[model samples]
Target: MGRLLLVVRLARRDLRRRKAEALLLLLAILAATTTLTLGLVVRAAASDPYGTTRAVTHGPDVVAVADEPGDPIARAAGVVAASGPFPVAPAKLAAAGRESDVQVVGRDPAPTAVDQPAVTRGSWVRDGGVVVEAAFAADFGLHVGDPVTVGGRSLRVVGLAVSAAMAPYPGSSCWVKAGCASGVAPGTVLPPGLLRTPGLIWLTRADTVELAADPVYLIDLKLADPSAATAFATVHNGTAATPKPGRVAQGRPSLFLQPWPEIQADATRLARDSQILLLIGAWLLALLAVAGLSVLVGGRMADQTRRVGLLKAVGGTPGLVAAVLLAEYLVVAVVAAAAGLVIGSLTAPLLVDDTAGLIGAAHPAMTWATIGLVLAVALVVAVVATLVPALRAARVSTVRSLADAPRPPRRVGWLIAASARLPVPLLLALRLAGRRPRRVVLATASIAVTVSGIYVLLILNRFLNGNGPYDAAQVRVLRHVLLVWTVILLALAAVNAIVITWATVLDNRHSAALARALGATPGDVTTALTAAQVLPALAGAVLGIPVGFVLFAALMVITDGDGDRVPQPPPGQLAAVVLAVVVAVAGLTAVPARLARTTLP
Candidate 1:
């Protein structure tokens, strides 16, 4: 207990003295944890609105449609209750100077036991007025008393409502004509057609009959065991070519069936896409965090060498010294993990669809599993970065550590000979880079990660802007995902550049002061420090271009397997990105290098 308390006090003092670096460490872990939490929770958050809508509307377990009109309930087994055999047909709807293709459903004025559309505004289906699906109404900015032209006839919007029969607006499950498919398919781009982005409207039976002479019939069923829907759909649709002795045969009347699980999955498709992207981005950020923290730990190790020696001289064991060094980061990691959990939970709902009609206000739930995962990641980052450095510091002899003099640079005969002919800044940068080759590699890798992320962003931006299958809303959602990823990547990369430059300055301060005494100007020392980082940034940017392409291709193959269809970014754009990254790195490192040089004794 005495040793533990002593370690805690020392760690606390160290953290307070290096407040900026401690904060940077905290932020690095926090960024990764926040992104990980979002990836884990987005899918569940998206389903909240649908679940609420389902409960409010008494949504069906399965919706079945047949061309030949008959009793839909009689054809299916295990149904506790059923509604519909309502008339459905595709038609054009024009309102507020905007025209859209819509599937109009004709229902009786009275409600049924199952699959009742919950009217959220105005009255239910009347003689000449129509009730629009709530999400659809909101998309088109329509309200009660607004005039709409449907199927060549004018009608006032009577009500707005929500139902669990299908997905929300622009994600309906039924199409107007053959070849216009329903439900979202992986990698399926929307072909130009009537059903690509459709709306839903409700009308009276008489009005629907007047609109379409031959309308399909729909039946909504509530099953005793909702989980049996897939089996029920197979049997009802007669999809099995070889039936059992008492089963229905293939080539029967065409029946379209949508199970509830499918409906819920469709509702969360946009969220799923965002989730996948964020999860990938979280991993990338984790890699950056590791690199950044490793460099930071190395810097801290140099700064704390004498402190370690002093403690050892005062009878502190190496184990106690190591504990003190590691404890500071562990405490910061814990705090960062907690902050990430709170922020991520509160921010997740904003990424989901939460229109008033689709769902009530979302209350994001934080599970113990999520907390455990986040903490595990944060601790892994801290341990991976700090362990080796702490151990090395602990193993140093007390007398040598207490000497507190800068270590001599290793001799590299060829490097010195080659650099002697170069300009002073370039010569100093090359010598400094060769001095700490491992740190240079890490700095290069950090820039590569950032540039690779930017490259992927460019590809995704182009894909979203192109004529691929997503609607405007989906495109917007995907763009939001890209924006989040870009912001985090750029911010962390900027932090890394400055940190690396500052660490270089600190490690070379003794040499720099000697150079000044030997007539090397402050300007030359600052330029050398900045140049060391800029050279690595340029190489990283160049290497990152191909890595980004490979990563984007792999992600596309995993998500859609349509790499051939994805257009490659132009060469000029990639070049521009590389140039921009180099410039940004130079700029980011400039202030830190200048400050370090100006403060030199």
Candidate 2:
């Protein structure tokens, strides 16, 4: 207990002394944890509103539409109650100086036992007036008593309502007609953006009949087991091939059935995609965290060496020394994990679609499993980065540690010979870079990760801007995900670059002083330090272009599984991105390098 308390005191004191580095570590891990939390909670939160709406409206287990009127779809097996044989037809609606395609359904005046539309505003279906789906109405800024033109006939908006029988508004499935092309030759894929965004409206039977002469029969069924919807759809849609022989010979009405789960999934597809993007982004941020923390830990080892020696000289055991080193990061990791959980839980609901007309807001519950996983990841990052160095420092002989002398730079004959012919700045930069090749490699990798992320962002931005498979809301959600990813990546990379430069400056201070005695100016040394990082930045930026492409392609395969067409950014844009990264790295490292230069002997 004494040793443990001693370790805690030392760790806390060290953390207080190096608050900036500690904060950088916290921010790095926080980025990873927050994104991981979002990925885990978004899909769960998005479904809550849909479930609430389902309960409030008495939503159906399945909805079936037939080609002809008076079709007995309600007689299908497992159906205990049903609504409609209502007339459903496609028509055009114009309101607020804007026109849109819509599916108009004619419902009876009286409420039914199942699949009732819960009217939230004004009266239900009435003569010469129409009710709009709540989300669809909100989308177009329509309200009760607003004038709307349907199928070229003027009508008044009487009510706004919600139904769980289909997805809200534009995400609704094709009910009035087949929305996509029916057939095509093998290997000839259809172009995307085939489905037009459509809204839903409710009207009286006479008004619907007057609007469209051709109409389809719609039925919403309540099943004994709600989850049996898929089986019911298969049998009713005739894929099961279990229909009676006489009915098949008589050419029974063609029916299209949509299950409630399927509808719910459709409604939440944007959230799902956002979740996937965030999950992938979380992993990328983890890699950056590893890179940044490794460099930070490596640099701190030099500063802590004397402290380690003093502790050992005072009779502290190696295990105690290592514990002290590790404890500081563990405390920071726990704090970062807690911060991430709070921030992620609060921000998750903002990304979810609020189209489902539920009574309350979504509060994504933070489960213990999620917190444990995030905390574990944070600890792993800290341990993986600090363990080897801490153990190495702890194992050194007390006499050797007490010397506290800087390690001699390796003798590289060819590097020295080649660099001697260059200008002083370039020569000095080359030598400094060769002194710590591993740090150079880490800095390069950090820049590569950042640039690759930006590259992917450009491609996604282009895809979203162009007409693709996604709708407006989905595009907006993905853009937000990209924004989050870019911000985290840039911040981590900036921190890494500055940390690397400062570490280089400290490590080379004695050599730099000797150079000054040999007539090297402060400006030359500053340029050298900055140049060492810039050369790596250039390589990383170039290398990151391809890495970004591969990463994005892999992500697309994982999330969409060959379904989406992943677009590649233009070569010019990629080259420009690489150039910008190099320039940004030089700019970010300049301040620290200059600061280190000004303080040198």
Cα lDDT of all candidates, in order? 0.82, 0.81
Q: Which stretches of candidate 1 lie over 4 Å from their true place?
A: 71-75, 181-194, 230-253, 466-480, 516-519, 561-567
TM-score (C-alpha, index-matched) for candidate 1: 0.90
Question: Residue-pair clashes per candidate, as listed?
Answer: 1, 0
TM-score for each of the candidates = 0.90, 0.90
Question: How many steric clashes does model 2 contain?
Answer: 0
Writing each residue's lDDT as its tens digit, candidate 1 over 1-601 gives: 5988998899899999999899999999999999998888888888888888889889998887777569555445598888878888878899889987688898999998888888999989999999999878887889999999998899999999888887776566653433243323334555554343568899998999888887777888899999987777677765422111111122224677777877877677678778888888888888899889999999999888899999999998999989999999999999999998988888887776565447566567788999999999999999998998999999999998999778788778999999999988888888889898888999999999998888888887876776244556667777877788789989998988988988889888888888878878888889999999999999999999989988897787666546665678899999999999999999999999889866686
Clashing pairs in 2: none
lDDT of 2 by residue, 1-601 (tens): 4887898899999999999999999999999999999988998898888888888889999888888777777886688998888898778899888987688899988998888889989989999999999878877889999999999899999999888887776566667653432112223444442224558899998888887677777888899999898788877785422221011111223687878888888777667878888887898888889888988888888788889999999999999889988899999989998899999999998877666344345668788898899889888988887898789889987887889888799768999999999999899999999998888888888888888888878877866675344545656777887788779878888888888888888989998888888999999888998999999999999989889878888877765533244467778888888888888888988998888766676
Cα RMSD to the true fold for all candidates: 5.0, 5.3
Error of 1 at 109 (Å): 1.3
The TM-score of predicted model 2 comes to 0.90
